[model samples]
Target: MTAAKPIRCLAFDTSMTCPGVAIIEVRKGKPTIKALSHVKPNTSRSHAHRAEVIEGWAMLFLDKHVGTAGFDYVVREDFAGKTSRSNYPVLSAWNACERATSRFGLTFAKYKKPGKDTEYLGISATRVKSLVAGSGNAVKDEVEAGVRRITGYAGTFANDDESDAAAIGLAWLIDAGVIEKPKGAG
Candidate 1:
């Protein structure tokens, strides 16, 4: 539990099980968590009626966060690019992110090492695991343990996707230099 940063940011997660949005504003040494939302998604394996709902939800989220001042960047979970799998939920998440960025005119990006030219950086699952937990090959239980240790939430928060999304946001916050890096590691 270190000090937060004086930076404003919005993070989102879109999928069949969990859809979430969070807005964190930091300024003048004052950090404010303005908004955080998570709802059970109305989705299906085939992505039934998902695009329309995503558009609507993304519009609402944008209205809430990017009303007058647009967000600096939009961060979403990046699919591992496994062409063999037919994960409609994963595709839906990617598509929803794409739609959100286009709808709000927000730039999409990832934090890749030594690559600053493109907005989309190569963030992989191993990196996320390591960033959220201590090891790249950490299991879900380990991730939840790290998250609980970091956030100090209750027992019900275990295995929740929203909590994982928040951890991902925290990772980006630290990576972007928006927040102070974790102790003993960068």
Candidate 2:
């Protein structure tokens, strides 16, 4: 019997200063992290310039991966809320990511804030943490540790941003049934 083809996914945690990105492949319903990286914006520049630089970086990252064997899905963490005063930059970056992914005809799945509902498709942050760290309230380090434990990833993570991004991707894998739920997850 032949094995089922793997599903390749590109996931991101969008931010103004640094955005986390990961490419994963699911084979036989098991997800494996293939590549992980972050887009660091030049903070010395003005806000507008920073946004442009971040968008350009994001585009470059996507361009580099979109054609390499091609990705079957693109996922990202949704904005926390629209009312926050600091949401503008994040929204801008997210919009750019959406546009970039759409240009390739890929529908980006936006994982919403934990325990919230919106018109767009999403999975809550609480759900992501619970699935990834066995606790919805798991702190950054714990979540990062959980991701390494679950994926058996051996490389050192650059920062919490990348870890969170990886967690976001792992959440999508669990939600899509590409991977089994971690033990003790509620």
User: How far does residue 24 in candidate 1 sit from its true spot (Å)?
Assistant: 2.7
Q: Which residue pairs collide in model 1, if any? A: none
Kindly list the per-residue Cα lDDT of model 1 for residues 1-186, writing each as its tens digit. Answer: 966434656666556566766565656533334566665655453465665576567677677767776666567655555563556666766676677668777866666754455544335556556776777787777766655554444545423565556556656665666655444333
In model 2, the clashing pairs are: 114-125
Cα shift from native, residue 111, model 1 (Å): 3.3
Per-residue lDDT of candidate 2, residues 24-98 (tens digit): 788877677787888777877776777777667677777777775777768777656757558877887787767
lDDT of 2 at 132: 94
- Name the top TM-score candidate: 2
Per-model CA lDDT versus the true structure: 0.60, 0.77
